[model samples]
Target: MAGMPTPHVSPGLYEVFLAVARAGSFTAAARVLGYTQSAVSRQIQALEDETGAALFERLPRGVRLSEAGRVLLPHAEAVRDRLARARAELAALRTLDGGLLRLGAFSSAGAALVPRAQAVFRARHPGVVVTRVEGPSVKHLGLVAAGEEDLAVVSPAADRPAPEGVTLHHLLDEPMLVALDRGHPYAGRRDVRLAELADEEWIVGNERLEDTLFRAAPAAGPRPRTGLMAQDWIAKLGAVAAGLGVTLVPALAASSVRPDVALVTIHPDDVPYRGIFAATPPAPTVAATAFLGLLRETAQELTPATGR
Candidate 1:
């Protein structure tokens, strides 16, 4: 009886087996494969040796498949077809003709920077699929580091360092603006100093003073009164529109704020500009690299003077 077949056979052996079965003769298969008849005979013998079964029966006229060869025909064909499909899909990804792009961005970036870049990327590579998620910059940064996201737009906290395996590409430095009700005393001012608002009630997203927009500024005088806390942008802006309190807005979000609210630039000396960055892995995928370029282009259009 034949010994047990080899457990780990090469895919090339399967290809040779298939060719011989199709041509029905060693000479014909060798001619098709650009090999000599002896080479084809040796290949078939090696395959039979590994399989421990006669894959073909020798006859006076030609060769014919045996029981073992008949049984493996469909499996060999399936492997060939599957490998061909994989090669085509891989080629498509290389050419930007097809693939998935996983993107993440902070809330403010979703307003214009990310969306505009996404639009251009879609136009340029229609066959590529794109998915976007919005959340805090820290969360996006972690996701990028974990390889869950291909690229992310973030405004990382100056105090916190990015997780391992993540690299940040600076996109721009965004100035901060103060949102006040239309009827406020300084609403019409083109710009204002942070000290000027010391007496005014401040609307904040978090209770911790360090987490709010004022974090960029130094602890010069008394902390501003943050009596009201509204986590949602809509609630925060609503409070400002109702003359309840003022909230700081990133320049990227100025256009998206309530029309009734006034936006005045904060003197750079009071609060430094925040850095906007694209987080990526050490070696980004082709789709991710393309999208990064689009992000830079969109940032330029959004902030020509401040964009890096």
Candidate 2:
């Protein structure tokens, strides 16, 4: 003998079935659902065809569930309950009143921008949990593409622009500052031209950041004489304080520099600047949207170009 076929139930059919089961009559279900009685009967017929069993017993006054419907009742109720819970969860996430926001950022943003935004967002929406991961810009961008991070704070290298499957929204253009020892010859100057520092030994935070110096260097200018390779901001500042070498600093970080080191603006027609971007997938999550707004707000609020 052939076996019975599996039923293919849609969410719509479940609603109709549940209405008819509760109302105990096609006319009453139709009235409750704003459908005609004939429409309700047709829907029941289609459901019966799909399930390969009669779910309602026709009576003179009303209808009652057949044995098949009684068996399906629990499963139908379970699906309805699960869907309701899912909708509620999604609503909470959309409201930003409660949910998890996974974010990634490069070192500089983690130090200043990310923290500032997180503090504001937490105060505004205490139920939302914001998590952060710090790494290179490329790594953060990749995480955003892979859906591991809802959004990322990245300063993408010019040559290696944003990759496919990710959108990088420009937030700000951050100027580079030269960190010098307080006693350096040009430390007292308000702003020193990059040309004046061509002869000084440099302390680079990261080898990759070497390009920042060159971009502001004069065409015929000699390359910076680099000595120490430090990755952390404090260490780079410490090196400059000890007179090991001067290092480049971004405006976002100038406020954090130690008093031992002075941050000087580079004067030139073309000042080297890094672009900060909020990276997201084509469709961003609700929490991502809220956090991105906070990131941009923090950037604009703290931007030296914007006045502080």
Candidates' lDDT values, in order? 0.85, 0.82
Q: Which portions of model 2 miss their true places by more than 4 Å?
A: 1-3, 36-38, 54-67, 89-102, 122-131, 142-150, 159-162, 165-167, 215-225, 281-291, 305-308
Question: How far does residue 143 in candidate 2 sit from its true spot (Å)?
Answer: 4.6
Per-candidate TM-scores read 0.90, 0.78
> What would you estimate as the lDDT of candidate 2?
0.82
Model 2's TM-score against the true structure: 0.78
Q: Which residue runs of candidate 1 sit more than 4 Å off their true CA positions?
A: 1-7, 207-212, 304-308
**lDDT tens readout by residue for model 2, 141-252:** 8888888998999889886756977898888988777888999888877677766777888877554666755754548454766667787777888989998888887777
CA error at residue 119 for candidate 1, angstroms: 1.6
- Give per-residue CA lDDT, model 1, range 168-203, as digits (tens): 899988987888999999988878988888888888
Look at candidate 2 and tell me the lDDT of residue 83: 96
